[model samples]
Target chain A: MQWETVIGLEVHVQLATQSKIFSGSANKFGAEPNTQANVVDLALPGTLPVVNTEALTLAIKFGLAIGAEICTHSVFDRKNYFYPDSPKGYQTTQMDYPIVGPGELEIELANGTKKSIRIHHAHLEEDAGKSLHEAFHGSTGIDLNRAGTPLIEIVSEPDMSGPAEAVAFAKKLHSLVTNIGITDGEMSQGSMRFDVNISIRPVGETTLGTRTETKNLNSFKFMEDAINQEVERQIEVLESGGTIAQETRLYNGDTGLSRPMRSKEEANDYRYFPCPDLLPIIIDKSTIEAIRATLPELPEAKKARFIADYQLSEYDADALSSETKLASYFETCAKTSDDAKLSANWVMGDVSGLLNKNDMHISACPISAENLGALITRIKDGSISGKIAKQVFESMWAGEGDADTIIDAKGLKQNSDEAALESMIDEVIANNPKQVENYRAAEADKRKKMTGFFVGQIMKASKGQANPGLVNKLLAKKLNG
Target chain B: MHSKQLFFTSIGLVKPFELVLEQTMSVTKDDIAKVAKLARIQIDAEQVPEITHGINEILSLVDKMQQADTTHVKPLANPHDATQRLRADEVTAINERDKLMANAPESDSGLFLVPKVIE
Candidate 1:
């Protein structure tokens, strides 16, 4: 019997606020451990946790973006837990009442299947400090610079079946958070983290099987691999007549397996109670509406607009909209050039390929959007063929010159004039009389392909600058006659 | 259930609820020690009982969160919308080698310090 893996992910996003959640300490990363920390972070005597309004506003902004209900009154709770990283004996978080209610996220799978992942709720909490084991003499050192940093833990329903959906969901979430200007969503720096809850059951099993919660999945590859391994582990356990234990586990990338860490705990174990130090957050209707007004065009909406406005294929639009930087660059190029489709093709194809090859980003591209637009415009205006424009683009990419200057300096203008193009077309026909005869005797379908070959030769002879439409018309006329 | 103390007395159970060993979720004192070790914290051995009790209590709280009819509940993934509040996408900050080394536990002129390597 086949088994289906059900997955849910709880992602922790560290807010990009300048200060800590409760203290005035800088929320910056990579600082001296205790230097940026304050008395509150050290959990000194008589220091109380003062909730940051900016952090709370950031949480509400997230709620509005996902169409979740913003709770006017929400309370912070004390999660009693002991750990070296949590300087405060108890972590201050939202338990009984979170600031935001249920939300939803819709992600498109690789196969173009759209799946809606339901968000249970998002709550604001303080992050724990980092433990640097590489430091200290035979002991791990604790850095409280990240301690008390505000984070919003977004929980999702167990709606995903496989790794692809899980990854798509993660990328969608990462893009959404970064796009909203909330967090940098840098997985490498641990700014964003994912903990996926995975469970596998027989194809038609009604009751949910034992689930394994994988922690510290910092990258998309890890997220996908972790889920696949855990699912396989559970399936093996059930197949061998051994019961799978519901527990927290760690993923070992090298071994491609998950090892149990501990039993998963329920929330009540934290002794959660409303934090008395901080007051309940009350957001009025106007606040939510004002936040909604500031939201920019989301990726889904932008992708659709690219398809409609630029007359681009869905694949091209999706690729262009994957990164905010790339989408902006495309828009910038489009603003100056009327050939939006051509611009999309270049940006998504050649520009993207070059950037990937060099391990660069669109923002790091040496070619400015105006220069790229000039290259496309040159092609459209018969100054260069599509092929020569690519060469000009390569020159522009190397910071040599703009399209117009490069074309002039290299004498690469298209031979699109009636006389000039006809001369090249006739030369090709004269050199290959057999091909010309075949072009005459071939069926309509074969004739169409020959037209492409003849056009290619004319453009090649003219150094990729023969007017393609005129070359096609002249070649057909010459071959037919 | 309203007269909870009286009802529990009638059922031969008392206030604070007499937790049966067989049914009390069974987190042993040794398990608590192991959990603290996994969490990488140093706690006095004598404090294990109290810590175990506290962790059990907290775990019960997490249990309550899971029990709440969250069948249709969606988890909030991030607190912000899907837009990057991008800065000028330009490098503005520079790493100060001197100041960065100043705070190091041990350092040399402008480099971080390490223990002697060669004989």
Candidate 2:
């Protein structure tokens, strides 16, 4: 029986701020434990949470970006819970009224399918401290530095059906948050965290099945795998005449299965009530629109614009617009050389491959945009063959300046001279008499592929400097008749 | 499953004692105990009776929330709705070791002191 896996995600993005949400303490990441803890962070007697104006503004920026309904008046709720990670016994969060409500984000599946994940609401809350185990001696240590940090948790509607869509949604959220300069969206640093709600239903059943929420799966791949594994587990249980119990499960990365942790509970489990300390936040239309004005062009709009403006392939445009830095770099290069397709092709194909292989970001790329544009222009002008241009790019990777200097230093100029390439083409033809006879006798379609082999030989004999177009013309003449 | 009349119904049709004895519709004690364990809070068996009662009360509240046609209602995650105000990207302060460590239970030589960290 086919089972549809229903999935939704709750992502918490640590807002990029300099101070703790309610306190004046510096919101630095790597400070000593408890050192960054101010009186308010410690929740000392008489310490009150003064709402950070900057944090509120950041939340508004997100609301506008996603086209969410910005609530003019929202109240903070105290969610009472006990955990070592939570410095305060209760977390100050939004329960009754959230700041941003009902928006949609578009995610592209792994199979190149695109879907929109409907957002329920996004609200600002304080992050709990980190419970560091095995970081010190045998005992666990608490880092209050992260405590009271401002975070915006974006919750999604249960609109996704599989892990691929869930991953796409997460990635889309990551790009949106980072592009808006709201959060770093670093999954590795626990900067962005995900809680996945998963359930399995029969192929055509409309009524929702019981859902188990798996919390804190940081990596995108693991989150996707965990959802798939949990869906399979739920299906097996249902098929065996058992019903899914609404529960919280733990995803063991080692075993690649979710073990039942405990049954899930209603929100009142924490006895959620309005927080008394902070007052209701009232935002005006002008305030929200003002923040909207500052928002960078979002990923979807940017992707569409890149396609039309740069005349880039959808794949190339999508890949380039995955991050702001790469999109900016590609745009800068295109502006310099007016070669959008070339810029998109190079950034997506070569530059991205290099960065991923080295585990680096585009901002840290060794090659600058201007230099890359110069390299593309060289390839365009036939100053170098595409193969030799790759060699110059590798030299630039080693800290060499632009294309011309690298090409000059390495003698990578294309052998565009017709006589020189024609002689090499003759040598290729002389060496392969039998293949040439077959190529001359074969059908038109068959001869087309064989021409490539002759071109390869001529390009190789010329030490990768043979201009490909000239080499192809000469090889075709030498092969036919 | 038999739908037992709940004790705390809007209409007083059933007795509270009969409601506790009836195990047809509501969640069982075993499930509540399991949920408490999953929540990582230690609840004594003697407290199970009270915890189960509390859970039932909360579940009923959730049922009420679910009754509200929330298909159109957006689930809220944050309370403050506006762009987060940002500061100019710059670092302005450094840690003052003595001042920071002043609140430590024990300290010496600008570092917080704890009993025998390692042998």
Candidate 3:
């Protein structure tokens, strides 16, 4: 029997606030361990917790962006667990009444079809500290710098069927959050992480299978890898006449393996109740509207704008507006060049290729958007052909001067001079007599194809500096005669 | 799976003595044992019943308060329907690793050292 996989994702995005969620502790990343912890974050006996208004505001922004229902009154619950990472013995989180409820995110699959993944809910919660086992010399060390940091836990419905759809959903989510300027969505620094709940059943089965959660996958590639591995593992167990145990498994990303951290027989009891320290966060309609007014242009809206305003194809617009930095970079280039289609193509093609080759993000690209725009401007004004502009772009990527300077210094401008282009075509017709005869004898449609041969010769004789359109006109005049 | 309630003081302007209905869940000897383990406290088996009896008598009064019949009363996280004061999202604290480590029982390399924990 064929198998089908069921997947749902729970993502934790660290809100880009300057302070901890419930305390005034500084929330900078990579601080010395325990340094960012305050009395409240450290769980001192006398310290009282207070709600972070900025966290609430950002959570509301997320709810508004996704069109989720913003719960007017949400209470904080203490999720009790015994661990060194949580010094307070419990994590303060929203349980029954999450801040956001029942939203959907639209994603585009690699096959160019749209999918709407329903989000079950999203809640605001405080993060626990890190447990360091490697450098502790037989003891575990705790880093409380991450403790009490505000996070929005987005829970998605079990709507995805495979790893590809799951990754598409995650990438769309990352784009949405980063575009809206809520979180940086940096997977490396643990800014955004995911816990995948996956199960496999026989194909066409209506009921759900037992799911085993794989915890704390920080990158998209590893999340996909872990899900595929888990699905295969479950399928093998069932094929061998075994049952899939519901457990919490720790995924080893390097080995593509997972081991059960908590088996079905040894599940921890996380006693949860309303936290008495915090008050119910009462959100009025005015507050939600206030946050809605402050919303930035989200990714889907920006993509639509690219298609509408710039007349870009859906594929090009999606590629150009995938990231905020790239989108703004493309916008700057397009606006500067006044050639939106050309700018979109160059940014998506050459710029992205160079960025990928050099191990850089669009933000750290060496070539400025303004300079790239100027280069495209040269191409538009017939100062340089598209071929010469690529050379200029390569040199500019190597930190050479601006487009005009590169064109002037290297003599790489297009030779649109009519006489010069004609002379080159004359040289090609005189040298390749057999090809000229072949072109003159062929039918109109067949001769159209032979024009490429003469055009190649003319361009080669000019050393690729001659204008192709002018060369084509001059070649046809000389060859057809 | 054990479910037990831990007492936490309400900071929402509710008087401590007036929160009588919060005590409906009476603590049993089993609850005391489970809570002691969760809190990482040392407790003798003989003392569980004594502590359970002492805690239940107070809880009985709390349970009796539930009969006051406040059907129209809304459930509130804070007794007072007061709005919370908002704080600007700013970095008010700085790294004080040494001062913080002074409060820890043990420390090494800017990290709090605890007994080896897995999972």
Residues B1-119, model 1: lDDT tens digits: 21323222222121121223223343568875654553345678887776667656654654454445544744332233321121222212233444544555764333233442111
lDDT of 2 by residue, B1-119 (tens): 11222222211212111122212344568875654543445667887777567657655654554545555655343345543333343233344545656766764433334443223
Q: Kindly list the per-residue Cα lDDT of model 2 for residues A1-481, writing each as its tens digit.
A: 8889899889998988888788777876777667777667767678787777778888888988888899887777777665655656689888668888889887777677778789999988999986545445544555567888899899999999888888888888888888888887777888899999998888899998999989888888889888888888888899999998887877777777777664322333664655656766778889887888898898888989988887888888777887888889999888876788888778888998999999999999999998898889888888987778888999899888688998888788887899888778778888998988888889999889878788777767888888888777777777774
Residue-level lDDT of model 3, residues A122-207, one tens digit each, is 99999999999888778999999899999999999999999999999999899888887888888899999999999998989999
Model 1 chain A worst lDDT run, 10 consecutive residues: A262-271
lDDT of 1 by residue, A233-269 (tens): 7888888889977778888767767777644322224
lDDT of 3 at B113: 96
- TM-score per model over all chains: 0.74, 0.76, 0.89
Per-prediction share of native contacts kept: 0.00, 0.01, 0.62
| Candidates in descending DockQ order | 3, 2, 1
What is the DockQ score of candidate 3, to 2 decimals? 0.42
Residue A369 in model 1: shift from native, Å? 2.8
User: For candidate 3, what is the TM-score?
Assistant: 0.89
lDDT of 3 by residue, B4-107 (tens): 23332211112323455544656667877766665566767887777677666656765776677776766655576665566778777666778868988899
Alpha-carbon RMSD to native, per candidate: 9.3, 9.1, 4.1
